[model samples]
Target chain A: MAALNYIRSNEKKLKVIKSNSITFDNDTKPMAQHQLQPENWVDLYADYLFNYAIGRISDSEVAKDLVQETFMAGLKSAKNYKGDAAERTWLIAILKRKVIDYYRKINSNKGKAEVRMNYSAQSDAEGDWLEEQVADPFSSFENSNIENEELGLAIQDCISKLPKKQALVFTMKTIQGISTEDICNELDINPSNLWVMIHRARTALMDCLNQNWF
Target chain B: MISCEKAAIICNKAQYREATFIEKLKLRFHLLMCKTCSKATKKNTQLTSLCDKANLHSLTENDKLKMKEILQEKD
Candidate 1:
């Protein structure tokens, strides 16, 4: 009889508790949708965004400008923000667009010379692999050794040595692991061009690594 | 019936995970018979993994702070 009385008394309290979450949701809609603070974003994502841009742009000054542009765009679109992605991802997406735009403008003006590979050097006139090009069967290049700081620096140096367009494609595709379709769309290059650039980059890096590490 | 040079290209495409299934099978078949191309493929894959392992290119703290101030001024 005592237990039943206690249960009866708490029924109204349980109902109130059940409705509290609904009341809280109704009150916090605007706050939930509010844009992330700009200052905090600098603390959180500036380095990341800058690095991402610099890797592709290959110039710190230009990279910084691009990041700044991303922030400005973000601020402009803050009111229309939808909370689908994390703020960092959203910022990076904006930065990607800016980088793509920057390249598109550069490409339009200069029509930068394509980095042509001397296929004849690596293969026969008929395009068969030359014995010299395949001189060594394999030289053990271990990438699993994460503690290999020297190897890392060597790779960075090699990447820096690549032609600007090749470096951009290499960083975006190989290092950043961005999709090939996105890379082609962003750089305004076809898939065949992207593949050629990537191939040249890999060959260059391999030769560099072989000379430096192995 | 892909030549070694073509096999090498396909091997590279495979390293980027961009090779078609048929191309991948072709490359695999080529590698099974050609020791030189197989070794080349291994090195190519290693290069990609090394790049992944060495992935810490970021802006300096000072620059980040400067960016923050710059962005703040626009607000």
Candidate 2:
């Protein structure tokens, strides 16, 4: 009878182990599932999305509007978010569309004529000739614009690769130009600590950008 | 003479225009003798200009608050 009871308890222990493993699996499942947090969106993603839009559009007012619209569109379509991408990635995708739509709208409106005129004004030697009015393939302005955009994106990419606190400190000081005291107060760090973070961030950023930018 | 590490700190502060006049003088003196620190300073300055050229801008606190309000109202 004692041997029989021992076997019964071992079986019970096996069942308990199996159940524990199942619970562990469930605990980890939600971590893999991304959830939208709209309340934190502004604080977390506004700057990032703004930088992205401004890099492409070069207008603060329009970039701000695009970021706002992207948030609205994100909220409206939050139900359809499949959690396949991170929250920032998803918001950026929406912002990209808003930027394209803005350009399309301008292209289809009276602004198109102004743009064409501006292009023609640059190549005055051609003097109103229809074929010559087209944008010069080798225009320095166009080339620089493309280069600047690529450089901007590359800088943003490097910033994103920094550790979270470093990225926050670097962006606030370098990009946003927030005062050191304000940054210290906002982040609840001492002045020296803030400086340390800034130093480390600058070092890491330079190293990262040197690989691609310099 | 400040150590290379301290010079690096001052160099970073100068990049943000926060280094004091004395600190700036010290950093400059240090850079004059130290090749590595001077190279780092040059790259650091270049990085600052690149950032400026990028024209990266973020929403102001008021703008962020407005965004939050808009999101809350829509939600």
Candidate 3:
């Protein structure tokens, strides 16, 4: 792009861009490239890895197990560490694989039988969602002055009620803000199935909130 | 111009930043003329924020310590 080329050609602008792009924990200070310290790995990255795993899988115990497994794998494979990415980034990559493996194992054991919802039931002959069904009384609920704690719990309750596939897609896409391509690849779902799953998840949440909160 | 049903699908795609540029333009035009769809779109955005605010937590400190011991044992 012209803007990229312009920034590249301008020495001062390039320096500013490079400095701003250095995303370290401290302000503008690049991460220290230290050797992999296995002892400090838990203190340094346990919370981050835990949160990442918990977000993907709803079970806290399972998340803990996955993070522990990631650390173990990290320790065993420490010799292969190239120090290319940030330590946190490398740890996160390992945790992600552990999560994928968890899902793969669970699905295989369950025979990949997913709870499928009839999408057509939500719509009419004209393809519009049935008006009676899509009652969004609290359209302004997000921006309203409602207590976030209560709202958050209510939302979590709603999510916990959804089917496994819908919940996974919804959590990954809407909550985690992961890319569709990555979510699809991770879940072994196609683009259309991803959209359908998202649609069902949202509809379920909407209905759940309407019934309970609104 | 897209139908309300198509617009609704596109709106979800837009929420995920999966909508193409042309799809985005079409959705914008549809939203201007369609109140119901606009409401649905707004609710969709709110759903995301609410979940984010609820902010599901990770393992507790004790759990982390237990897991750390497990990792150490595996090492």
Candidate whose lDDT is highest: 2
* lDDT per residue as tens, model 1, B25-70: 9988988999998888988898877777666465544676687787
DockQ of model 2, rounded to 2 decimals: 0.52
lDDT assessment of candidate 2: 0.83
Docking category of candidate 3? acceptable
Would you give the TM-score of chain B in model 2?
Answer: 0.77
In order, the Cα lDDT scores of the candidates are 0.73, 0.83, 0.73
Worst lDDT run of 10 residues, candidate 2 chain A, spans: A115-124
Q: RMSDs, each prediction?
A: 24.3, 15.9, 20.9
Q: How well is each residue in A122-194 modelled by candidate 2, as lDDT tens digits?
A: 5556555777647776556765665576677768778777887888888889888889999999989998898
Tell me chain A's TM-score in each of the predictions.
0.42, 0.57, 0.45
Give residue A75's lDDT in candidate 3 (0 to 100). 89
The TM-score leader among the candidates is 2
Clash count for each candidate, listed in order shown: 0, 0, 0
Q: Which scores higher on lDDT, 1 or 2?
A: 2
What residue runs in model 2 are displaced by over 4 Å at the alpha carbon? A1-40, A56-58, A82-89, A103-139, A161-166, A178-190, A211-214, B72-75
**Residue A7 lDDT in candidate 2:** 75
Candidate 3 RMSD to the correct structure? 20.9
